[model samples]
Target: MKLLLLLLAPAIMFASERTVTMKVSGNCGSCKKRIVKAAEAVDGVKDAAWDKKTKVFTAVFDDGKTDSASIAAAIVKVGHDVEASKAPDAAYTKLPDCCQYRDRTHD
Candidate 1:
């Protein structure tokens, strides 16, 4: 039992839950949905939320399985721009008219 506990200690220590917040570009309800969905889709992400008014996105995830970079990449892939990653032109262009935040003045 002592050996088992010792062996599992490292794994338990490595699997820490972390919360990260960053600015993301978005405009409306659809944008919020896309942002949250993209962030939450990453492996190890427990949950995610976005506030359109503030353009801030927050995510809770296991550091052992994922990191902020991966979460940002997921959001970028789905047509949103996060502090660590930018959505590709193709992805950005695919956004709906109401969700196109880049053309306007925003954070």
Candidate 2:
């Protein structure tokens, strides 16, 4: 009975959601629209907003289903630069001229 109680306790104590704030460089309004849209598109993301002043993306997501790093990666996947996340080289190079965010390593 005690073992069963302890196992259940951890589940009940776990968080359901988490909020994250992180930077992603961008140039203009189009970047804002694209970044915000991509962050919201992830399956477990609950909400997302971009701070133009700080160049940051703020997001809330279900902890049980998602995480901040994955959210950052998703943003990067769509052609932006987050602090710890990066677009794959091939993906970065394919962007239209205006969508390019930064120089990436050539392979």
Candidate 3:
């Protein structure tokens, strides 16, 4: 039992919950939904939110299973540009017209 406890202790210590925030390009409510859904879909992500006004994507995840880079990749896959990863033009072009933020001058 003592040996088992020792084995499990390191894993427990390393499996920490972490919160991360990063810039993600998006325009409106549709973009917000897509961004949040993509971030939360990662294996260890517990919750995610995006503020359209700030273009910030925030996520809570288990560090042992995932990280900020992985979360950003997920967002990029769904047509949003994250600080750590940029969505391909193919993916970006698929976003609905109103959800597109790149061509907007003020964004």
Q: In lDDT terms, how accurate is model 2?
A: 0.80
Angstrom error of the Cα, residue 89, model 1: value is: 0.5
Note the clash tally of each candidate. Answer: 0, 0, 0
What is the Cα-based lDDT of residue 104 in candidate 3? Answer: 79
Q: For this target, which candidate reaches the highest TM-score against the unseen true structure?
A: 3
Pairs with backbone N, CA or C atoms under 3 Å apart (clashes), candidate 2: none
Looking at candidate 2, the ten consecutive residues that score lowest on lDDT are 98-107
User: Ten residues in a row with the worst lDDT in model 3?
Assistant: 98-107
Better of 1 and 2 by TM-score: 1
Candidate 3 segments exceeding 4 Å error:
1-6, 105-107
Model 1 C-alpha lDDT versus the unseen true structure? 0.90
| lDDT (Cα atoms) of all candidates against the true structure | 0.90, 0.80, 0.89
TM-score, one value per model: 0.87, 0.73, 0.88
Q: List the residue pairs that clash in candidate 3.
A: none
Error of 2 at 14 (Å): 3.1
Candidate 1 residue-wise lDDT, 16-76, digit = tens? 9999999999989899988888888799999999988888899999999999999999999
lDDT of 2 by residue, 26-60 (tens): 76677789888998988779999886657888999
